[model samples]
Target: VLPAVVDTAGAATSKTQVHAEAPDNTVFNWHLGDKGATEAAFKAARHVTRLDIVNNRLVPNPMEPRAAVGDYDQGEGAFTLYTTSQNPHVARLVLSAFIGIAPENKLRVIAPDVGGGFGSKIFIYAEETVCVWAAKKVGRPVKWTSDRTEAFLSDAHGRDHVTHAELAMDADGKMLAMRVHTTANLGAYLSTFSSSVPTYLYAPLLSGQYDIPAIYCEVDAVYTNTAPVDAYRGAGRPEATFVVERLVEVAARELGKDPAKFRTQNFVRKFPHQTPVIMMYDTGNYGASLKKALETIDYKGFGKRRRDSARNGKLRGIGFSAYIEACGIAPSAAVGSLGAGVGLWESAEVRVNPIGTVEVLTGSHSHGQGHETTFAQLVSDRLGVPLENVSIIHGDTDKVQMGMGTYGSRSGAVGMSAIFKAIDK
Candidate 1:
């Protein structure tokens, strides 16, 4: 008989008998904030709202499928891999240091004009490693390009989670605390940067835009037989937003309160608000933002619209979501303390040629996000040069020297900041 299969995330979460019950199958089990304190607050709350949220797996199919070309320079004892990658530096680091392909100085990875990544191409896969290794053994360059079918089967998938979340509230409808438990499906073997997604990237954002006094979150990540799951569009923040917004909507309905007013009541008004789950929000005007959104949507006329829809034998509903995301993965000290193996910082070098043209070498890669245009505009505006005269160079590990790559919406914020600093120097 074939071995028992646990391919789907739903099957992996079945409690009757764990499909992945082996000790090693448990990838991560960790919690944020004081569980005891949050539970006690929940017990004493005048009102409580609970929600069970399930997000299925998602596959990223970029316009261009992933491909790799590996060339070995036999005489120089060096290897060059031209592949579809978001971060060539990280790819080189993993291949040389961890995969034992070669020393860092000998292995050079180049990513050129990648069509798109959507977080899928950010990983170093077996095909690239194999191609590079085989090039040496065969004494020739090896090239492999992924077709659509191959991509669907092998590309790192994203966002498979089962979550149970609760919000504790006082009699006046003010949020007291929040408690959340999640089971993330990592699928098969761990991929690059997979371990951080459902943990640090998910739980910390559970507080959302609220002012809950206490919050606790627990995450248990497991391995299944499906393709390896990692970050996708919005990564963990979207999942966290769904949970918080759904709970808030339900809570408003149960309290016979307008969802807009209910959300406004709990919005975090103060600056430098420290959440129990390890986030320190510096500042925000949640009430103003909500008011503007409500006015823009004509929220007061929603009842009339719903009644009109009923007359037309149709259903009408509106939803509100207050989302907060931590972007620009930066400040090496912070990421280092949080278990990042590599520094999350970006790097850049600015050079002005004698002909009055500028070359800006950045670690940020552009996979359809137009980093070249935006970075060029920044340099052109600052340096008083025409946009065409400023060239943004990136992707190749040899050219860049080092980089954290582009993801988590960091190209503009973190990457440009590095370029700005270099220009200043």
Candidate 2:
């Protein structure tokens, strides 16, 4: 179902309808999903089955919130910003474009003592941009830090989607057709990975591990009077998994079969399985994993446990979930094909010092992901060097050349993959 974007005045009058108008110079088309003609089709669909409306807006409540200290040197006309960020190089590029500053080389970004991000500190915030511009404009050092409340209201939120899904099954309980209509809340502005989250990340995973033959999804990303909704943890995959797995379980219950058996029966037991939603799973052992889990949990004994619980006047239900996730940020071509504005490739540079020590500079910044230890271990394992002899450097724009930053569980798969390439070179 398409969400209705209304002004404060329009919402007061009509609560459930979208109004479209020409974009003015002050306002850009920042809505999440379809626009123009595509939006018209979403508004016309009838018979929405499973309506999921989520409106829990969580602002970034970092313990230290957000802080930025900037200094511009008049002699070189260069600028440096110390802030809490997962990717300083990306921030510097964004700041240069937004505030009309110097190129990336002239802008140095340092992330020092960042408390926690939880996906909020990954973006180039307006506060950071303004502070850096003010430092250069006023010809003095400028510093700005966000209070707890400010962080709460301004920090990006996650997973605000209203969705309706329907599954059509055949006589043997095989899923024949599936359809989903979603209205994703984009808040006021579109965050960096915001638009692609619902469309590419969310929709592509709708196929799940099941062998559903036909599937269709229509997502209408809406603009709401709230904070921007972006990636959090598993991002769109968790939301998609919730819908697909829950529906599969419900279908199993309706068919009067064990959820695990039903899933095993429908599981795609093949490699390079292609779904209708444009994702080709490289490899998986669905039935093996399910069987192993059942053995681990003593599936046969659940009936006795349930009966004992019933005698004690307790209603207990045991549920099993077997899910498959596609992570590792993916290839650049894959991301670009799916309408991503940025490249998904990571960067790494391995340099051997004159004293026989090794240094690795990576684009993947670590926010408690333990890059120092893990990266060093990789270097030690690969080059036959001791872990202590390798030092991994990151999160500084001046220290690294180019980077796409880290998120989407991509640090190990994409970032380390890049590091491996560097080591090989």
Candidate 3:
């Protein structure tokens, strides 16, 4: 459904008449940090630098496009769906509860051998929903697969946003505060975790690798007539990093200071440094990482590389952008308070057979992420089992009780952490 754009500037008055549910063409409005504190800091700053960044949306073309097959057993009032999904449990939640397709127990969802997700396969789509519902009605299996064109046309796009951010700095070039106003284009309808992506996930990381004492961020999640936008790759963190790093780089240039020196001066030195935003970074050696990176690149050798390129009638330049993310999907209570509909916790089951072999069931479904091998390695190293003797299971609702699935790069940090807990238990 194409939405009528009320305004191209993503104004609050913008209207997307595509769906009756979203009357104003707006999905959600969210804010974080102390605005009063941020404004006061800005007033006191010796320098104020502003930058506008637009993270244009793009389609993720997976090697294997989305496909699904739904099977129903009329006699037992049961249904089974073999589909391409990053998280089968999340799909079942929406299908059974939200869509009223079937009871949770009676519905079984399976995702297997997925080629790639890149955050696209995590959400439930109309094709698989209809496939399962029609199977139950006709008492036969129903199947559908998206060709490349359909996949390209229908799958959610990633990171369409317009942001205006300003950094307030002292005479010595120390950052004192930050103010960011971001207008995120959510497209026609909100995708799974779409509201959370630009709001909670995006705003919290505005602090980046710095210790900005005051940070105020506002996100206007607007609706437009286009493909829905959802989480992809680094999700909001990358966008936040882009904003912070770009602003920092610009601030350095405006102050006539070497960018590396400016960044090093602002590196967060302490463990558990809490920014004005909601994130609390537990530990990182930002300065050390910068030092190492600079050393590895050999800052002194840039002149030689540039000279060699100059001889070939080309110009060479070197630049650096330092960024840090507060890792982990983390702390369900934390996410829920920020308006998440569901808890982000993952589930895992470690089943050790009598034959001394191991089977690991994780809530995470892999699409070429090597989850099977990585998760199995954890079991092998922990249980003292051979890697060949360990098997990893995932992406089946009946086989695995519950899982939040992999997105926002959580499969490794959050998913495996769950398996580690199960193994410990």
lDDT string, candidate 2, 361-420, tens digits: 999888788999999999999999888999998988888878877778889999999999
Model 2 residue 395 CA deviation (Å) reads 0.9
State candidate 1's TM-score.
0.95
Q: For model 3, how does the per-residue alpha-carbon lDDT over 362-399 read when each residue is reduced to its tens digit?
A: 88888788987899999999999899999988888888
How much is 248 displaced in model 3, in angstroms?
Answer: 0.8
Q: TM-score for all predictions? A: 0.95, 0.87, 0.94
Candidate 1 segments whose C-alpha is farther than 4 A from its true place: 7-21, 332-337
Q: Give the poorly placed runs of model 2, Cα more than 4 Å off.
A: 1-56, 340-342
Note the Cα lDDT for every prediction shown: 0.88, 0.75, 0.85
Q: For this target, which candidate reaches the highest TM-score against the unseen true structure?
A: 1
Model 2: lowest-lDDT 10 consecutive positions: 22-31
TM-score of candidate 2 relative to the true fold? 0.87
Q: Which is the winner by lDDT between candidate 1 and candidate 2?
A: 1
